[model samples]
Target: MVLNKKGIIFSLLAIGLAGLFVLLFATGYQQRLDDQNDVIRARITSLDQGVDSFYDYAAEAQTIAGTAALDALYQEINQSGTFLTSDNFESNFTRCLNSSDGCENDLNLSVLLTNYSAIIATSLHADVQFSVNDVCLTQETFWDLVVRTNISISLTDTYAAWDTSRDITTTISTVGTYDPAYVAISASYGGAEDRRVFPTSIAPNSSRWNISTFMDFYKGRQYQASQNGSCLSDRYEGSWTSSFQGCNLESVVDADEHPRLKDPANQSITHMDWQVLTRDMHACHDPVTNPDDFRVSISDADDSLVLWNKDTIRYGLYPDHLDFSSPTYNAPGCP
Candidate 1:
């Protein structure tokens, strides 16, 4: 009995110790799992914040770009008359780099600078083209002095966009009545196969010539008169020969040339051939006339006129023609 009792005690002690060990181990394991959970939660929160920050930055960038583009457009229109021509457009755009109140907001100005620099560089290297249709004349001599005229201007531009080619176009029509008395005479004399005269008209008498000839004479006189203030000594000036004096002029002539020679018989219809005097004027910018942060460039190409990265301005006479005015006929010397 004594030996059996001693064996039982030893067995009981071993079992008790094993149970304690297992309990302690289980407690430690649970604590470790809790610590790991906390770490994971902290990491996830940090990741979320980083993603939010990235989106905010992108949104800000977009806003800056959009505002800068609009502001630059407004400035360009206001200054179009002074510096927005084809000749000085590049230089004018460079001047826009200066940040004034109009373009000085830190974010917007920075965006403007970045984009404009790229645009200017591209424009400088880009190819441009322009064309004009000669004025078509439907009427001949009206009152032997005035002529009607019509003209068209076309421009076009081609360039690369995203490594691909693109094109834009602009067209304009200008009609006005002009006095033949003020027209410019070509270098050649005696209607000597002058290429300037088109759809030639001949009169029955030597004194009264066709409207085309009269217009040529008027144009020559106008140019000369512009320089000297008078149409005297012009080649078109000549004595009225016999037989031509009796011809009746068109009614349009009486409306164009009144006062003494308002006879209805003295008027006749004449068409004026139009020619382009000037094309591809350069862009310009004068700090004295306009004070702004951004610069602009304008060009006419492929029958399209562009104000370089901006909307067209309506402030000046030429640009105004873009919005208003249709072509009409008057004596070349009426002005």
Candidate 2:
């Protein structure tokens, strides 16, 4: 009888322990579910924010592009003999051709394009200057008058976006992880691990060649742009004629003492035929920049949106940057 009583007690204890295990497991699973739900919520929030922001982004970009006060201001500036000018723009581009063919005209298209979907972030400034009357330009005229322009973004902004993309992904990845790391960027997602990089520079013709890695960080918000066949090409035999009277460069003197830069002053040529597209863009931010460097009337825009002045537009196009600090989830089993 004593043996039977002891066995009964042992059975009770076993049943209680089993109940406790189930309770504890239930609680832990609920917590994990909550964590997973939180991540889903964050993803939803980010997407919703992007969706809601589309209108504002479009409006803001449009205001800068057309029919807004900024456009009016540009028009006013353009009219007041305050012509926006880009001059002496040399093609600081290197050949990215794989063919052993010569670099000349190897670029089938003058390309200055973002590889992914992009919206104008922060502030944008567009300036245009064309001649007042149709003018004939000979080799002498192109040398004399000059035609040039630039389309560029600041290095600070570019690098900031690069770094921030990784940071944000890292911050969002701490859930359900042993040691949290950043989200992985894949090649299809524009990951850049296969190429080479020069961490110290992004200069024109700086040979900042890295394999696919340079573009790995390109998250559609960032940029990789190239411009070619501008001002000098096979079409005009290297001479450019202008639709306006005389180019703005007519008033400017060469800061350099190169004899080839000297003006020929041969004004007798007529019927201009050749053309050039001065679309020079380099990404660099000087060490020192302030509110004035991005000069625009910042009335009621997002604080993050900035407008950079000419002086603030620095030259590095690709800075050597790689971070393994945040773990990369380049391949998530999740769709």
Candidate 3:
């Protein structure tokens, strides 16, 4: 009976020991699983931070680039009369092509570098693209002029109410008539001409008459008749007539009536007045008229760097899926 009791006690003790072992094993297994899960969460978090950092860097770069471009545009527009000659254009363009570090002095290279560096430092991969659009030269001109001349002539009766005389005075006067008429009835030989015989009458109802007048008597009728004659008559008339005849006087006196007569004969001679001419001329000479299109791509190979690995694994960093895109870059002379 005692032996049976000992066996029963031993069996109970064995069962208890087995239960403890099983409990310990399960607890250890659970702990290992928990540790693995924590590691994975931590890695994911680090990857997210790295990705954020990269994006921050890219944003900074884009801002710098945009500012630089704007500054360059302004400088080109407001530059002084040191006008961009063909040689200057070519030299500047060549420098840009050769990636000349000195070009920054003439342009806003500091801004570009800030942008480029920011992007390169933050991103696992990067590249640069530049381009230009259409360019054309424009020209314009401006001028001022003065003209001087003198002549003797019969003017239209613009102020008929103010004059009632056969003799027009030596004083200068302004008239606004389209036409006027006169008549002469003279009996004269070669004797000194008489002015009294000549009759200057403003027809009361004449549609074109503005004024009329009579002159003092003179010995020579020939001189009076000659005064009322046409411009050609003043040079060729040798004799005076006694018969009455009608005469018409017409003239044009405004020099400014024709406006376009003074303009530059051609565009090539007048381009300096236009503000855009300089820029267009430079672009034409430089041949930088169009911008080029480009694409930015990133692959897994770029993520192999230690920093990237640390971000991905230790820091749980991950990238925002690259926005694979074919983007366009435009500059001054691109089409």
Best by TM-score: 3
Cα deviation of 30, candidate 3, in Å: 0.9
Pitting candidate 1 against candidate 3, the one with the higher TM-score is 3
Candidate 3 deviant stretches above 4 angstroms: 69-335
Candidate 1: where are CA atoms >4 Å away?
A: 1-4, 69-105, 108-335
lDDT score for candidate 3 against the true structure: 0.25
lDDT (CA) per prediction: 0.28, 0.24, 0.25
TM-score of each: 0.24, 0.23, 0.27
**Alpha-carbon RMSD, candidate 1:** 25.5
Ranking by TM-score: 3, 1, 2
Q: In candidate 2, what residue range of length 10 has the lowest lDDT sum?
A: 166-175
Compose the digit string of candidate 1's lDDT tens values, residues 1-335.
99999889988988988898898899899999998888766644543433343234323443343333323422443233111333332222223322334443344423443444344335443322211112111111222211111212112223222221112121111112221221212111222111111122332222333333334433442111011111111112211111122211211111122221223332211111111111132234332343221112123322211211011121211222332132222212111
Task: Please give, for residues 1-335, the per-residue lDDT of candidate 3 as tens digits.
Answer: 99999999999999999999999999999999999889767654544444444344433433333233322322332232122332233234323322324433333323443444455434522222222121111111101001111111111221211111121111111111101111111111112211111222322122322111111111111111121232211111111221223221111111122122123342231111111111111112111221111101122323310111101211111123211132222212222
